[model samples]
Target: VGRIKTAPACSHVPELPEVETCRRALAPRLAGRTLTDAVTPWPRAAATPLVVTGRCIVRLDRRGKFLLLRLDRGWLVIHLRMTGRLVVVRELPPRTTAAFQLDGDEWFCLVDVRKFGRAWQVARASEVVGHLGPEPLSRHFTAARFSAMLAPRRARLKPLLLNQRFLAGLGNIYVDESLHAARIHPLRTANTLSTGEVRRLHRYIRTILRAAITEGGTTIQNFAGPDGKPGRFRSRLQVFRRSGEACGGCGTIIERSVVAQRGTHFCPHCQRL
Candidate 1:
């Protein structure tokens, strides 16, 4: 069997933009395609495995980082937590955790090295992603609504934004970029932001997400589209993984710190705590 192409193992998690990229790429290829068979080399990856044979794929959708395959009968929800990749190829790739055979001689494979990815077959998509917060790019996420959401939260900015229940689709990369653009410190209290700061933060968050999606998401470790292309947004990053690099806004050197138990990057001069 031809080995599946894999990226070197890294800690980067596929966030909203990366997941959206996969959804867009797979939607057209998978729409109306029937699942001929199901195989699970790592059975634990199928959180709610059910009979997927003969189920026609209606469409591909995404919520936060979960890719939703809308089948004729039920939904196939996939979450690529870390080092998990979804690729459609004619040949089976190595390290395939789960694979769905398609009628058109194509195989939809979930190639994972760390085995943290999960798949769920459920009657409703809500069974898997019901608890996720609002999509950052959706129209319902207005500036005023964002301000209201942050008014009562006492959690730190970095951890609060990382929480999927607070706001969906943002991971370390976009969060740092957005916070840097908004001039907010990652450790700042969420409720301490002024109205103007809140507005700036909300706007920057949306802007950065849209930009990343347009660029096919930032690929730090293993993120790639179904077409096997790495994200182009990594080159556009300002602070993430650029610890000693000079800040674009200010010449001050960028710094890295551990916040919310994740590596946080920021400009010491621009974002004052």
Candidate 2:
């Protein structure tokens, strides 16, 4: 199932809520001011220790829902799995779930997407290494890398998309949407893409992930943005959990099944293998 064995035993990855929670968590302190230190109360899961604590925060951005803490020494790349959340509590959440501290005044909580995916405590900014895949938008993660990633694996594309080591920050929501948008069968094997399809798939993957980040990701369950608000993207979904619902484009009923071991949705008519 492409599991990395982080902490918990859940069966999910960087779903929509975890990303949105991170955006809300650091917006207040990270927007205008600077981050002086990085604290990992949970050594096994939090990002790297502090680097640019007192300096001005250049910006806080999301790379596939992975919170990129752009600091002076490096980027504090935070990956929230099934239950990851970057909550900015005045002190602490007063609950047992109070996981770790990121900045001085801010606190980060790894909610655990099955507690599988882990936070890479990296020291280099924009320099991801070993076992990490290409950023969908980066110049390095070109059509070549995308093609190469699938060329060798026989795994299902849905699970492949969820693999951060292959492509970081992409989760179930974006994968489902990308498959639907590209009209490519999600269950197709890795080596099935043509040159044209690879380019289109590349564009759609970036496009879909970018759009979701703009929409703040989908909210199905207990996920709330960093400010603790519900996300609205779920209402705008085409085929995510809307089984038996008419396809937004072709009006065909959306179908649901297990793909790559995750609950997946698609329109049989609009998207064919």
Candidate 3:
């Protein structure tokens, strides 16, 4: 057997943009293809395998950080908790937790070094993924709506943004970048923001997510498209992981702090409480 390849340690979780990228890359290749077999070496890695086998993948969709593979009978929902990756390759790579074989000899592999990935098959997609917040990129997520959503929350800004139930799809990198762009402190209370601050935050959140998607999402570690290509958005990041570097907006030294239990980065001069 050829040497097994493995993904590197991931610094960030697979968020909205990354998950959406995976859906887009896999949809074309997987849609209409029937699953001849489904295998999970780590039994806990997949659930309801009987429902997945022999089902044709009709489409692939994404919500927050989850990928939904619509099948003829049910949906297969995948969550790459931290370091999981789904790739379609001629040969499987190392650390494969689960795999699905298509009728055409093609294979879809789930390689997760940390074994944190999970998959579920259910008759109703909503049963497994219905609780997620509104998609940030959707037309339903207007500035007014976002402002209204924050009006009653008393949590800190960074933590609130990280809540999948609050805004779905924003992880650490984009949250930090959006907070910096909006010139809002990560620790600012959610309900304390003025209408203008809320509007700016809303706008930047959508803007940053769109830009990242256009660039195929940021790849901090181990993230790649279904085709095994790394994302390019990291090159366009302004504040994330740039601690101690000159701020792009005001030349202030970027600083790092612990907020919401995650490493937070921002420009001390640009983003203030």
Number of the top-ranking candidate, with lDDT as the measure: 1
> Any runs in candidate 2 off by more than 4 Å, and if so which?
1-28, 31-65, 68-77, 96-129, 224-227
Error of 1 at 71 (Å): 0.8
Q: What global local distance difference test value does model 3 have?
A: 0.83
Score candidate 1 by TM-score against the native: 0.94
Select the stronger candidate by TM-score from 1 and 2.
1
What's the lDDT for all of these models? Answer: 0.87, 0.62, 0.83
How high is the lDDT of residue 97 in model 1?
94
Model 3 stretches with alpha carbons more than 4 Å out: 1-12, 222-227
Per-residue C-alpha lDDT of model 2 across residues 133-184, encoded as one tens digit per residue:
6667677878877887788888878888788777876777778888888887
lDDT per residue as tens, model 1, 19-65: 88778877777899999999889999889765898999999999998
Give the root-mean-square deviation of each candidate in angstroms. 2.8, 7.5, 3.0
What's model 2's overall lDDT? 0.62
What is the TM-score of each predicted model, taking all chains together? Answer: 0.94, 0.71, 0.92
